[model samples]
Target: MKTILIPVDFSDTNTNAIKYAADMGCDMPVKKIILLKSYYTSVYEQILPSPDFLLISADDIENERQKIEVQLKELMKKLKNRCHENIEIETVVSTEPIVRAIHNVVEDQHPDLMIVGGDMGHELSMIGEQIIEIAKSSPVKVLVIPPDCNYHKIEQALVPCDLEAVARLGVLKGLNTSHSWLNPKLMLLYVDPKKKHIGREAEFEASVKQLVNCYECKLHYSEDKNIVRGILNFATEQQVQLIIALPGKHSFFYNLTHSSITEALSLNARHPVLILK
Candidate 1:
């Protein structure tokens, strides 16, 4: 069975991600979902109470684990109810930080994908750094669920292509292997910010046609100044359900996160983004 590993926190992000996962499970090949909760605190050492008063004894640790296990069971029950399938849900309580725990699970469980809840237009901090690290480093594809976005079938996927991204065109064809995304129309979106064609028009069209041959696809050109906005606007206008992006030296992912005043799309996009690196 295919698995999706989700790191759980008590935030709205966790709930939204799980809901999205359950909805996707209805049509996709997702059968097993592993929910992970990492145990960590933000308090400083000096601020912590004395060991005698606050130390977690072995018994206390076990009790706490049991408590969280109950919570996880309840969470799993609720998530399963949200879907129509007989989904098998499991939970893990990690002793390390969330990111580290996720890496550990990836190495051990070999989950098919990991889902993240994206926050919009926020200041960079620990969470931002962790998200960037995971996206660039995860062995499997990483899907980001936008804020307030619900799970649904991907009817048409919006692909923002750069001249340099042709080599990674396999990302489009790979989508056809899945049940949920099988044969969804591929909208090859290219935001021609400048009116000048970079001379890769023919190559782009040919490559797209070859890769997504099993599915219907079209090449779209826009004169919007911003790359990210152009793709989102076009997706919204066309009611595209998924956005696939390739990350590399000259790709939109690199430009957005590497700029001095970064606009992190993985953290800010209003639609689910599949980062096919």
Candidate 2:
């Protein structure tokens, strides 16, 4: 049974992500759906100069906590009803920093995949940072659903590979698990560095073929001048719905700072990009 972790903050975007997950899980053998909510205590209020802080009793905090709990239960019920199935929905409430809380949950739950809503603006919110941090730290795959994305049709997926990382069973499992929703046409695109000789084409083909055997999806390969350009061009030509890529381990910090190839593709391509660690 595949487990999917979705962090919720009661925002409409997060709610949409929950709906998307349920819709996708309908045809898959999902074991559990985790909805995590993190709340911070009023440490800032305590430090504030306002004397009104003394007027608020401990009961006020407890009451707020209870309210959030009830809200989560109601949200779970609504989700179950919407999915029309008793997809196991679990909720966690934490006061830790959102990023730390997410990291802790991923560490403990070990979910197969994570789905989060992306912020459309230029600035990253707490939720956005949590999503990005989880994507970087998570051992599994992460999918950030854009605000207006249509989740029903993820038929064509483009995966750009440098063929550096050794493709493992865990990575293959992530791709196969997505097949339930996507039924994707997999494209393994490689960008030939300008200085390298074109004769290495045979070696690249053999490597890609080995990776292709790991899944049953249709595979295509292309050698382009630029990695990002190749991904965008192919996705545009094929009209793909998602792009999957392995983020390189080297210069992890740099990748996160600069818009990654996957990130760039997500912005420019006609589809979403799933970045797997």
Candidate 3:
């Protein structure tokens, strides 16, 4: 049984992600699906000289919260009806900030993965920022589905590993879990730093082979001057549909929260990228 956390704002994008997950669950094992909604009081609006705030009391907030819960219940019911198997659903209401709310939920629940929806362009820049924050801080893996993407059987998964750190069993466990649904063709890509000698490439290949032997997948290596450019180029050339990345010990998150590898992949890559922590 696997637990997946999905944060919803009642947007079509988020709902689409929900549908994708529900459909994917048809071939996989999902124990519980967590639906989270974060609500905040409009402090700025309260300061305004308006009648709207005056008419609204604590009771009004409670009533609205109750309404949202009812709507969520109906949505979950619809999801269950459409899914291939029965899945437990849990709903949460929070008044904390969005970033904080997500962190708190993950800490308390410790879900196996977190799924989110992305909207491109300037209108969604702030939403993108929040998603990036979640990706950086989340202790588990995070999957961001683009708005225009149709849920296809994920047949090929491109994993761009630099071979800089020892692969962890936990990370491999999560990857295998995704395999249950997509049964994807795993490509372990290693982009060697341009300064390194050719001999070092052989050593890296051996390490990757040993790490991935337990899992069923193919492996490939390439030398490139830039890490991000190498990954994007390979993904485009191979027509890869999804990319998976494991945040290394000295990952971009160490220096800045928003500059994580997953964030970079989201901003640049054409395919969806899954960030496994």
Task: Say which candidate scores most in lDDT.
Answer: 1
Off by over 4 Å in 2: 42-45, 49-60, 122-125, 164-170, 177-183, 192-197, 216-230, 250-270
Candidate 3 structure quality by residue, lDDT tens digits, 113-133 = 888877554344334547767
The TM-score, computed over Cα atoms with residue i paired to residue i, of candidate 1 is: 0.83
How does each model score on lDDT?
A: 0.72, 0.65, 0.69
- Lowest lDDT sum, 10 consecutive residues, model 1, at 120-129
lDDT, candidate 3, equals 0.69
- Clash-forming residue pairs, model 3: none
Report the lDDT tens digits of candidate 1 across residue range 118-201: 655443333334666677777777888776788778788887876555666676566567534446778887777786556767
Position 254, candidate 1: lDDT: 56
